[model samples]
Target: MKLTLDFYTRPQCNLCDEAYHLLQLFQDDWGFELSVRDISTNDTWTEEYGLRIPVLKYKDLLIDEGQFDLDIIRKRLHDLSSEN
Candidate 1:
């Protein structure tokens, strides 16, 4: 089973960049699909998530946002994988 991740982000955000990099590292380890969504490109996204950039979603469920923890993410990976 392949896990898909939604990463919400926007331009000129260092935290967004960091989250992207962290997700890349996680993808390498867990082999998941990552989709990046730039809030700046959409009005709805920009309005709702403007201040909450770098949010991560897994199957419509929010997993985390900003300052991701390797240990917590690793645990989430383990938990999600076992569901399959």
Candidate 2:
């Protein structure tokens, strides 16, 4: 099954933009569906990720936040794929 990658972010955020671009670069190769969410649109999301925009999640598991570490996410994805 294809995994879904949830990206929590808000507008006018440089870090978020950079993370988004990075995600897009490997999205196809990573073989996961990217679901981008604007935290500003949801109260709960806003409260949960207001300070941590550009959060990356796979299901309930948080993959990365803030500036986003590619190595961490790559390792996690590799581990997750191995499980299946």
Candidate 3:
């Protein structure tokens, strides 16, 4: 089985950029599919996320928000993948 994640972000956000980079860095190791969405592109997303950019989601599960450690995300992804 393969794990997939939704990475919610917006333009000109440094944190979002960092999160994207971190995900890309671990893509091979974690072997997961990533779908990046810019909240600013949609009205619903803009209202829903607002200032809470860079939210990571695995299906209905919330993985993390705001600033997070790369290792922490990796561990969480590992755990989630293991359950599959």
Candidate 4:
């Protein structure tokens, strides 16, 4: 099955770039899809998630991911798959 992930990112953020890249790699290897949004352009989103770029959302709920990495991504995906 295909899972939907909302990726919040910015243009020049290295961290965001890395997170997006990792997301792409994981999406290719695993069975999922990504929807990226640039929160910097949206005022409300910028205010709420300015510092928290590269946020991932599922089921309209934001994941509390403090740091981004491969193991963390894998774990989150695994955990989410158990919900259904």
Please write out the lDDT profile of model 4 over residues 1-84, one tens digit for every residue.
Answer: 888888888788888888777778768576679888898789987887888777888866765443676676677777887874
lDDT of residue 29 for candidate 3: 79
Which stretch of 10 consecutive residues in model 1 shows the poorest summed lDDT?
Answer: 60-69
lDDT of 2: 0.91
Which digits, one per residue and each the tens of the lDDT, describe model 3 over residues 1-84? 678899999999999998899788888878888999889889998998768888998988878889967777888898897888
Best by TM-score: 2
Q: Which ranges in model 4 have alpha carbons more than 4 Å from their true place?
A: 64-66
Q: What are the per-residue Cα lDDT tens digits for candidate 1 across 35-83? A: 8999989999889778877888887777788777777777777788888
- lDDT tens digits, residues 1-84, model 2? 768889999999999999999888998888777899999999999999999888999889999999888899999988888887
Ordered list by lDDT, greatest first: 2, 3, 1, 4
Error of 4 at 74 (Å): 1.1
- Among residues 3 or more apart in sequence or in different chains, the pairs in candidate 1 whose N, CA or C atoms overlap within 3 Å are none
Candidate no. 2 TM-score: 0.94
- Index of the highest-lDDT prediction: 2
Clashes of 1: 0
